[model samples]
Target: MYILLALISAIFAAIYFYYKQSFTYWQSRGVPHLTPSMPFGNLNKPWSIPLVDQVTKQYKIFKKRGERQAGFYLMTEPIYIPIDPEFVKNVMIKDFHHFTDRGLYVNDEAQPVIGNLFFSDGQKWKNLRQKLTPTFTSGKMKMMFNTMMNCTVPLQESIGQIADNNETFDAKDVMSKYTTDVIGSCAFGIECNSFKDPDSDFRKYGRLMFEENAIKAMKFLFSLSFGNLAKKIGLKNMEPEVAEFFTKVAVDTYNYRIKNNVKRNDFMQLLIDMMDKDNNGGQKSNFLTMNDFVAQVILFFVAGFDTSSVTLSFTLFTLASHQDIQGKLRQEIKNVLKKYNGEITYDALQEMKYMEQVINETMRLYPIAPVLGRVCTQNYTMPSTNLVIEKGTKVFIPNWGLQRDPDYFPDPDKFDPERFSDENKGSIDPGTYLPFGEGPRICIGLRFAMMQMKMCLAALLKDYEFRMNPKTIVPLQLGFGFVISVKGGIWLNVKRIS
Candidate 1:
């Protein structure tokens, strides 16, 4: 018994000494840093708090100190959070090559279908990104616009039903259904009809992807901090069922398209073409395998589904809370549609500039992708500093912090769409706004996402009015997890704009 206790004590002592050395990494490099604790780096009870909250808190602290950039740790791994917009631009755009990869751990063996453009790194990412770039082009988006417009039929009808019944509905849940149907049709070339049947397979699986799982979150953090070690232990960020389901759907769709000689002007059809390109007298080397093809489609659906939904829901919430802004948005939508003979066409949607400003303000306040992560791909010196950011160092740009900082955005908490108006928007500095990120790694589907959001918002605002439900908690308490979700969902009462 005495010998066992001594052995345990010795092992702990060794671990303590090792980590103690790691704590001084930033200080040794002459970089300003937050004080770290023994095991969890600078964080105390990190697991007990949401990463978004933690990052935002740290961002406030660093900003208050006027730090251009500050180093901190997540476990033993050092992370550099850049408070300066100049540094942010340098990492995101000016010096993009040095930070090309997001440094995410992919258990390809476990979740092979997850190696999409979003999570892929190095040459693989570059190759995939190059091929996928044309897929989201304006011409391609124009081709898929009709398909997306068809999906909104159920969205409007469902809202009409809700408004007639005078029943309060969860805006997130409602908008998620709309997004699911849109993505299902556009990306997978299927009819999800989530609005008609909320328990549809697409909706069910989509909800599972974002549902808060403590074990999953911990594993994700562990993988991010110690990627090599996590890989050795076979840590996977994607749920097994999710990977399996998406893989099956992708394979079945691909096989069906080939067998029936079917073709559609949707995202899945583009992927199908890429896979069948060799047979269609195209380059074999540029082609994606079944796994690669499926991965991109899944990413398109998953990433676009949740993000667009959250943005739409939050935009409604903002509009609901501020009636005057909502009224202006409705007027813009009404005028634009009248010009196009009441048709919500792509060109007409673009003319709704005030609507765009509203969405921008909503994104600023409740960016679903709260933090932008980048991993240094090479050793590079930060401008005006002797600090050499070593290769493979993870860098975080706290969008949540920068968007809300009083220094950059005066009256940051106020939901003023005028802040994004033509007259006022130029006053805002670049790099301070990155709801969809920037540069080459910028979201390929930005135009499509904006169109979908604008379509939904314009349709609803033109027909109905949204007001905050009594069930909705005041001040909007954020849910614990990665995404900046409202806790218990945002409930809202709907009324027809008669």
Candidate 2:
């Protein structure tokens, strides 16, 4: 028993010394850093506190100290945080080549679905990005416009009923269903009918993908911090059941389309066409396998449904709190639709410039992706600084902090859409407002997400006026998850516009 205890003591001592050495990394490099603690490092109560909140808090602290850059630790792993927009611009846009990869955990051999463009790196990412770029073009968005509009019918009906009944409902839940149906139809070419059948497979699996628990949080941190080691042990970024469901859906959709020679204007058809082209005579570099196809499909569904829903919910919540802004937005929607013969067409949606401003303001206040992540692919010196960020180092851009900084946005907490008006928007710094991120690696589905959001808001705002429900907690407490979400949910009362 004494021998065993000595061995255990030795192991613990070694771990303590190792962490102590690791914690001094940023200090040795002449960078400002927050003090790190055992096990969790600077990430205190990670499972309880949202990662975005922690990072944003850190960003503010460093910025207030008049520092342009700072460092923090995620466990023993060092993360570089750039407080200056110039550094952010260099990392994301001007010097993007050195930081092309997101540095996420990807073990495609074990979890084939993890091989999607979002998680991939280097040559594979370049090839896949090249092939998929055409899929999200403005012309393609125009093609998928009608399909997006169709999904809003159920949304309008559900909200209209709530308006007529003058009932308070969870805006998050309603928007989630709306986006689920939209993504299901546009990405999978299936009608989700999430409003009618809340337990539908698409909705079930979509929820499963983003559902966070302590175990999931631990797995995510583990995989992110020790990516190679996790990959060696076959750690997966997604639940097996969720991966299997999305895979089967993609397979069934692809096979049915190919066998019957059916072609639709949605994303699945475009993917199928690409696969068919690759199989026939496409260049080897551009070829996509079945795993590749399913991976992209899953990426589309996950990103498409969740982020847009969160943005829509927050937009409604903001508009509810500011009745004057809501009224002006509703009037813009009405005016834009009037010019299009009272039909919500793609062109008409574009003409609603103020609606764009409203959404931008909401995203600024409550960005769905509050932080942007990247890994240094090569040793590069930060411009105008003597320090060099080593290769493989993780870097975080505090999207939430930058967007809400009083320096960039005057009266930062206010929900004023005029901040994004054409006359004033250009004055805002380039790298500061990253609701959809910036640069080549910026969100590929941004236009699609914007269209879905605008269509939903345009559809509902035309007939319904929403107000905050007392049930909603004021000074909204955000929840822990991959995206920005309310702790409980955003509840709003709906009344028909007379």
Candidate 3:
């Protein structure tokens, strides 16, 4: 027993000394950093505190100290944080080549769908991005507009029923179902009818993707910290059930379309065209494989539904809290639709400038992706600084902090859409407002997401009035996860507009 105890003690001592040495990396490099603790580094109470909150907190501390950049550690792995907007611009846009990859764990063999545009790196990402760019073009968005509009029909009806029944409902849940239906119709060429059947497979699997447990969280951390080892052990980025369900859906959709010669204007059709080498005349050497097609499909489904749903839900919550802004937005929607003869057309949706302002403000306050992560592809010196960020160093842009900073946004916490108005928006600094990110790697689905959100808001705000329900927790405590989410959900009461 004594021998075993001594051996264990020696091992723990070695680990302690190693961590102590690793923690000095920032200090040795003459960079400012927060003190790190054992095992988790600077990440304190990671399981309890949301990463966005932690990053934002660190950003505030460093920014307050007038530091342009700071360094920290995530489990002995050194991370660089850019606190200055100029630095942020350099990392995201000006010197984007140096930070092309998001540094996320991707194990295609173990989880085929994990090897997606959002998670891919190097030449693969560049090539895939080139091919996928046209997929989200303005023309494609125009093509998919009608299909997206069709999904909103169920959304309006479901919300109208809740309004008539005088019931309090979770706005996030409602918006999620609406976006799920939209993504389902647009991405998979299938009707999810999420409002009609809340337990639909699409909805079930979508929820499973975001549902966090201790095991899921630990697995995520492990994959992030020790990616190679995790890959060797066959760790998955998502639940096996989710991966299987989405993969099967992709295959089934592809086979059915090919067998029947059915072609639609949605995303699936475009992917099918790219994947079918025979259709491509067998000339394109870089044509998409079955795995590639499914990966992209899953990416679209996940990014499309979650980001838009979060934005829509938060916008509703914000508008519900501030009736004046809501009223003004409703008037704008009414005016735009009036011009189009009460029909929500693509062009008409674009005319609702106030509606756009509302959405932007909500995004600024509660971004779907609170922190933007990138990896240093090569050793590069930060412009105007002596510090050299080594290759493979993980960098984080505290988007939540930057958006909520009082320096750029006066009275930052106030839910004011006027900040995003044409008159005031120009004064905002670059790199500070990154709801869709910036530069080449910015969200490819920006136009699609905006259209879907605008359509939903215009449809609902035209006829229904939403008010905050008392059941919603005040001050909005955020849950610990990758996406920004409310702890108990955003509850609201709906009433028909007279």
Candidate 4:
């Protein structure tokens, strides 16, 4: 009985000590904060509700608390959330030298896929990025345009079949298949008929990439719950099977092409040429290893397949909901395509200014990375403050909340494509808009994603009219897994316009 009483007293004392430690964090720095209670710290919501929603709520608190930045704990670790956009811009771009890494571990030796651009940091990232930049230039994109177009022809045929069958389809699912085919053809230099055959290798592997498992879920929670510690255990940002399958696919494809003297004007070909094979473009001979090849193809897959597919899907759904915007976009597409003889050529796609605005608006509301993450490599003192944050502080920019903030965007809940209009957009603050992120580490595949998106939209809008199906959830909620997706997907019924 005495031992039980002693144990209860010890537990309460531990609780009191934790609160004392957490509460003293901000008070000592002269930073303002709501007093934390017991062991939950300031992030109790994250433990109780959906994690994304918890992040969103913290964004609200930081924004309204009138703190330029707030001191808080993700459980026990201290993190700073920059409330003001100016501070965010400064941390992410101006002071980038102090925070060169995303703070995520890259166990490249243990997990090969983690060596890719998304997770790689410091000198290694710089070296790899320098070598790969020329691969996606305007000239190369033009060379690859025909490959994307060839896949689109199949997409159109697939749509025609769907329309004939009165299939009430999830535009998201269909677009995913279209993107899978395009990525397979362009990235791997192989034929993947995802539109005709659901069981294609590309399709299977793509599913493997995003499908969730208990291990993935636990790591996800742990990473958010205890990020730095989670990295020590060698948790990979991508699935192991996905990485193994892709590595094998890349090796087999490289071997088959070399042995058979096969060549295609695609990403794989460029990578091989860089290896001193047939070597187009008079590029110097450098041996490209399997990691080098897989990294390049994975970039194509990561950016090409998912982000574009999700962006295009949401745009279609948003346009269906807002007919006025849809009508204006259709007019722009018709005018631009007609200028190039009803074909979406490189130069012609550039002329679709209004279409660009609409896509920008879509990206604004549904940015693929709703938040930007960076880790401080050196101690950072909030501008004008004497408090120095120790190195390794995980910094976050909640683009989802900032983009939707009423101060930055009036009537923040409304879908207003003109928010991105040239005249109106120029008046808005530059730091407020970051759909593709900011600074040296912004998404490198922005142009590639846009070009594919523009082409697909042009083809679909030219021949079809889309309206929301009964299956679509109104005032859509963002899903919790993989990439941000509209819950229940964007279901649409189609009518042939031609």
- lDDT for each candidate structure: 0.87, 0.91, 0.90, 0.77
Clash count, one per candidate: 0, 0, 0, 0
Better of 2 and 3 by lDDT: 2
Encode model 3's per-residue lDDT on 1-498: one tens digit a residue: 999999999999999999999999999999999899988998877776666777888899999999999997888989999999999999999999999999998888887777889999998899899888989988999999999999989998999899889999998899999999999999999999899899999999999898876677667767788899998998878789999999999999999988999999899998877767545576564445788889999999999998899889999999999999999999888888888999999999889899999999999998888899999999999989999999999999999999999999989999988898899989988789999998889999999999999999998999999999999998998775757788899999999978
Clashing pairs in 2: none
Which lDDT tens digits does candidate 1 get at residues 1-498? 999999999999999988989888899997778788877887666666777777888889878887788888898888888889999999999999999998777777777788889998889888888888889988998899899999889999999999999889999999998899889989999999897799977887888888876676777788888888888888777778887888788789888988999999899988777767756678765445777888888999888898899889899899989999899889999988999999999899889999999999998988887888999999989989999999989998888889998888899999999999999999887789889898889988999999899989988899999999989888898875646688778999999977
lDDT of 2: 0.91
TM-score of candidate 2 on Cα atoms, chains taken together: 0.98
If scored against the real structure, what TM-score would every candidate get?
0.97, 0.98, 0.97, 0.90
Question: Which regions of candidate 1 are displaced past 4 Å?
Answer: 1-3, 278-281, 284-287
Residue 122, candidate 3: C-alpha displacement in angstroms: 0.7
Q: Tens digits of per-residue lDDT for model 4 on 1-498? A: 999999999999997787677677777877655566545566564433444555566778878877677666666656676778888887878888877777664556666655777777777777667667778898989999999888789888878777888888888888998888888888888778887798876778787777654566556656765655666787677777778878888889999999999999888888777765424545342224567668777867877888889998988988999888888888888888787888878888878888888888888888878767788888887787676867877777777888888999999878898887878888776567788888888887878888888888888888887888988888887765556777677899887875
Model 4: lDDT equals 0.77
For candidate 1, the 10 contiguous residues with the lowest summed lDDT are 279-288
- lDDT by residue for model 2 over 270-348, one digit each (tens)? 9888887877787665446788889999999988998999999999999999999999999998988888888999999
